[model samples]
Target: MLKLMKLPTAWGLRNASPFNLKAEALLTMSGQAYESIEALPNKGPKGKLPALIDGEQVIGDSSLIQRHLEDKYEARFDDGLSEVELADAVAYRRMAEEWLYFINLWVRWIECPTITRDAFFSGIPWPLRGLVFGRLQKDVKRTLHGQGLGRHTREEIYGFGEEALAAIAARIGSGPFFFGDTPRSVDAALYPQLLNVAEAPYDTPLREAARKHAVLTDYVRRCDQTIFAAREDLPNVA
Candidate 1:
């Protein structure tokens, strides 16, 4: 069985935080049976969530995990994508990983502070909610600053986010999924970022733009139902 080392379920919505969703999607699409290992302070890699453990080996980072899974289960992981399709898929995936990171930070910090705050509070046990909120706020601040997107105020970020979403939506207009016919690696990479934007507690114009796009809304719903079924259990790494 494949053992996924991941964070608590509540943190799953965080942007680069789609590690869990991607891992779950890969597992489900491949029809593989796997166990999950909750990564711990001393036991796992120093960075991020949704690490993978297969037998005695541990893999960290989503992209690396995907590669590892593909190598391990060659037939199952193979999408049989063509060369041009594969190139397009990888390009979009890169955009999702790199560009969406900033978009996510902007949304969480400047754009939807209230929603993030509430989400932070709700994620913790009642007793630790206060402490968790404080830590999360500080952490978010540091992350935003580190990413350089934190320099912009909410309004500025919102403007930028709107343009970004418009561009994405335009690209997506070319087909049902980013790749047209099938859900490719690009769809896997981009979907979660859009999902976070759509579902986040903010009623900003950017989110409104997302809501207006019928294709994006349908894509998100389909990804949620197909790749991330509500009942699927994730690794309980705390």
Candidate 2:
């Protein structure tokens, strides 16, 4: 049996981090028998969550986990996609992970800090919560700054997010999935992040921007019902 170490669920989603959801999506899509355990990033080899424990081997990062599944387990998430479609999928996945992710970080941690801080650090004792949360916020801001999106104004950042959502909506346009009717690896990469922005309990412009795209919200439901449905049966998911 395989074990997945991931962060706790939040906002009615499988995991707080979209990357964790991506890794689990890959596992479920691969039809592997696995159990999920709640864990912090430090437990992973690369100081990240969603580490797959296969016997003595610990696989870190979702992309590497996908490779492990493909090579070792013969799982093919994009079996039917054409080369062009595959390339498009890669581009969209990069947009979601790299570009839109920083926008989300700014909105959640900087714009709506109180709500996010409460949600993530509520378990910590009051005396140390401020200290711990301050450090976490600083680290996240530093990461966003390094990504360059944090350098932009809030309005500009939200504008970028709206543009990204509009682009995704234009591409999808009443689709059963990203590329086609089939759910591919890119769907695993994308669905969770979009869902987090659209459904998470925040009222920031980023969430508003995501809400503007009816196609995307519908797509999230479609993925939840089809691609991610199997995950609900997993033991101790939260």
All candidates' lDDT scores? 0.66, 0.87
Q: Candidate 2 residues 1-238, lDDT tens each?
A: 9999888877777676899989888988899879888898899999987899999999999999999999999999988778898889989999998888778878888888988878888999987998998898999899988889889987899899999989888888878798778788998989888988998888988888888888999998898678767766665544
In model 2, where do residues sit more than 4 Å from their true spots?
Answer: 232-234
What lDDT is obtained when candidate 2 is compared to the true structure?
0.87
- As for model 1, its CA RMSD to the true structure in angstroms is 4.2
Clashing pairs in 1: none
- Please state the error at residue 21 of candidate 2 in Å: 0.9
| Residue pair clashes in candidate 2 | none
Best by TM-score: 2
- Give model 1's TM-score versus the native structure: 0.78
The stretch of ten residues in a row with the least summed lDDT in candidate 2 is 229-238
Give the per-residue lDDT of model 1 (tens digit) for 34-134: 76654533455746677778888878777777787678776244367678877867766776666665767667665566666665457567668767666
Question: TM-score of model 2 relative to the true fold?
Answer: 0.96
TM-scores across all candidates?
Answer: 0.78, 0.96
Look at candidate 2 and tell me the lDDT of residue 78.
Answer: 84
